[model samples]
Target: MSLLFNSYPLARSALFSLDAETAHELTLSSLQKAYDCRLTRGLMASRPEKPCRLMGLSFRNPIGLAAGLDKNGAHIDALGNLGFGFVEVGTVTPKPQPGNPKPRMFRLPRAEALINRLGFNNKGLDAFIANVRKSEWRNHGGILGLNIGKNAATPIERAVDDYLIGLEGVYPHADYVTVNISSPNTQNLRALQGQEELTGLLAPLQEKRKALADLHGRHVPMVVKIAPDLDIEQIDIIAALLPRYGVDGVIATNTTLSRESVRGLPHAGETGGLSGPPVHALSLRVIERLRGQLGIAFPIIGVGGVVSGKQAQEKTAAGANAIQLYTGLIYRGPALIGECVRALG
Candidate 1:
């Protein structure tokens, strides 16, 4: 275990006493301050190099910090320093919006899970882009993914416009851009996952990407993030359409709304996607199924419920080209990064 994480248990206890959102804000703020003071590098152990190639980009390791944790690209440098092979930020929209409301984020500590209905709250594209450009890691060859979503107020039919705006805005600054159509919090967002809706959403983005690639002289891969609540049939439909539409990759899942595993637990009744250990099996099943459908060459970024090295390996073994962490970091701390790297290495 990394010595730097020895104090995590004590810290986790204190943070757990507060509301989930409050604890999250405090943690991010503290991390930002630590990074600003040059204290993070000393406080976290360096991750062992375990290079892997995906989406034609080389990652220092196969583990990445997942989106939603840094919704505005505000802490890329700080998060990058914690030993993630890559760091993804934002579900940023074209305009800034306050998201649901307070008490929107809840925790189920017994299940080592979280439920949130944050609604893609972020600082909009301009601020998100500015923060990305400001990151020291931006010019240092670290992989940074920009996850984009439509505004809450954007009509479901007009959602394509919001996504197109996001793609154009973040393309030059992102190593990859994730079209997040699977988030359960956004009203009618999940509707886009259906075959007809998905085709309408991705077809234009693929066309736009071609133009952007020509303009920038670089093709930034576009990956779609899906929901874990899908059945094998739905997974098959998505897997089949991805190649036809020229989509670059697929992130196996966002979070799930299923409460079967954590039923009767505190906050289980909250209306939001559930993440952490409870979703691990479901995520793995999706990856396994997607891999079967997409074949060996198509990339899949696996994320959900990976809180230890063993779970991380399970994701790769199940067919993830790379994996990401979010809820795990809340429960396990930075040590989880190194543990995963060592396991994958």
Candidate 2:
């Protein structure tokens, strides 16, 4: 192991001392600098060879970094070197969004969680694609997934327009495109998960995907990232619709609105989606329910609250074809990726 890998605890201490979003920006900036000088590769721990194929694409390992961590994909190469098999970027919208407001992201250290209402903040699809083109991670055979969402200003009824614009824009560049309708930060965003609303969203997107596939001469997969706060009936509805719309896969969860696990903890009352250890069980339950309904052949990417290798193992055991991390990476650093990969392998 390199010194940086072993010294992450100390580094995290310095980072945690800053404001949550400030710390986020500083970390990515430093990481991007380290990557530019080729310092990240040697600083990383050994990555185990644990290959898996999904969504008609081959992954170098089953451990992937979830979307939120590198929203605009400005640091894909830097993050990919940390030993992830795949790196997903964005919840990028059709247009620029300022997101909710300051103090929108709060740390729940006692609960090993964070609550954020960032509301898909980004420089918009055009800048997002520009950043994506600048990345060289694909030269190393790294898998990249582009996650898309509607702008916060866009009304709920016309949300499909934004998603279609996103899908079409990112289709040719992405290894897979993720339609993210599950984020709790955006007002009325999760309503798209409802039965009639979901049908209205997926039907048109699939039609666009088919046309795009023919236009580009390649069928880029479409995966839906869902929320953890769901009942069995909702899971069934989503599972049934996925096949009906030719959806390629499902990401078992986004964040949660529930604070049942961290009720008394500081920042517990904050109004945003919670993510970390508290969400592990809820995410697992959803994964299990999704597995049961979607069947064994369906692709399910498990995420949320995997703060340990044991949890990563549990995700796969509970029927996840693969696993991802975000909050866990915040607490444990880059080493968490290799640890999860070794456990899964």
Candidate 3:
């Protein structure tokens, strides 16, 4: 750890002083440089044993770096060096576009959470794939899952086109591909979560998946990223439809629009999705609902508000086969990964 990162207080202070989006960019850039220098490899090499095997993929441990953290594949090796068993990059669109103007991402430090309406901002599919090709982590052999979504301007009826375009772009390089239908910032994006709508969204993607598999000469898993705000009925619909659509797994919950826990906070009024401690309960419920609907045979990647080993264990107990974190890492630092893996053991 940097002398600057020795304490969460200092790291948070250093990072919080900057604009939220800029801070994110600087943090990832710094990590990428550290990885290029091999500064964190030794720590990663000594990680504890707690391998996870789910949905035909092998993870060295259960803790993964969730999507939205490194959206353009800029820090894959750097994050891989942080001891995450897997790292999902992008929510890449067909073309690069400046997402929702300035100040779109806000940090709720007091709540150990964030509210980002970043709207899938990234360098687009082409840049993302190029960055993945240029990354140095291939030899490290950790799982790399690509999270794909449509541009905000893309209509709901045509959403599958964007997904297929993104899926095909990253198929050869990604270990798994996540179809993101849950981001709150994109208008009508979540509507694709409806049972009938989802079938429409998935059918073509499944065909494309087969075509890609044949072209690449290997099978790649496709996972659906869903919202945590859904009711039990909505969750059951997804759980039932995922396997039917030939989807490989589900990312239990994305950031939520609910403000129940952070209601009175200063940043609570910010118009963005809330993530962190407040999201844990809803995220867990979604996993539980999906488990009941789909059974243990289906794979679930539980994410949201995991800042400690106990929370990670609770997610697994709630029906997750593996887990991911973003805001938790902001509050706890890389050391949490070691603690989480040990706790999972």
Candidate 2 lDDT (Cα, whole model)? Answer: 0.92
- Report per-prediction Cα RMSD to one decimal: 1.1, 1.0, 1.7
Q: lDDT: which is higher, 1 or 3?
A: 1
As for TM-score, the candidate ahead, 2 or 3, is 2
Error of 3 at 32 (Å): 1.8
Ranking by TM-score: 2, 1, 3
Top candidate (TM-score): 2
The list of candidate 3 runs beyond 4 A from truth reads 1-5, 39-46
Task: Compute each candidate's TM-score over C-alphas.
Answer: 0.98, 0.98, 0.96
Write down the TM-score for model 3.
0.96
> In model 1, where do residues sit more than 4 Å from their true spots?
none
lDDT of 1 by residue, 228-325 (tens): 99998899999999999999999988999999999999899999889999999999999999999999999999999999999999999999999999
Write model 3 residue lDDT over 1-345, tens digit each, in one string.
444335557766888899888988888877666666655544344345588788797888888989998889988887887778888988889999788987898888888999999988888999999999987665676889999999888888888899989999999998999999999988899999999899998999999999999999999999999999999888888888999989999998899999999989878999978999999999999999999889888999999999899999999999999999899988888878878898888
* Candidate 3: Cα lDDT at 227: 96
lDDT of each: 0.92, 0.92, 0.87
Instruction: Give the distance in Å from residue 314's predicted Cα in candidate 3 to where it truly belongs.
Output: 0.5
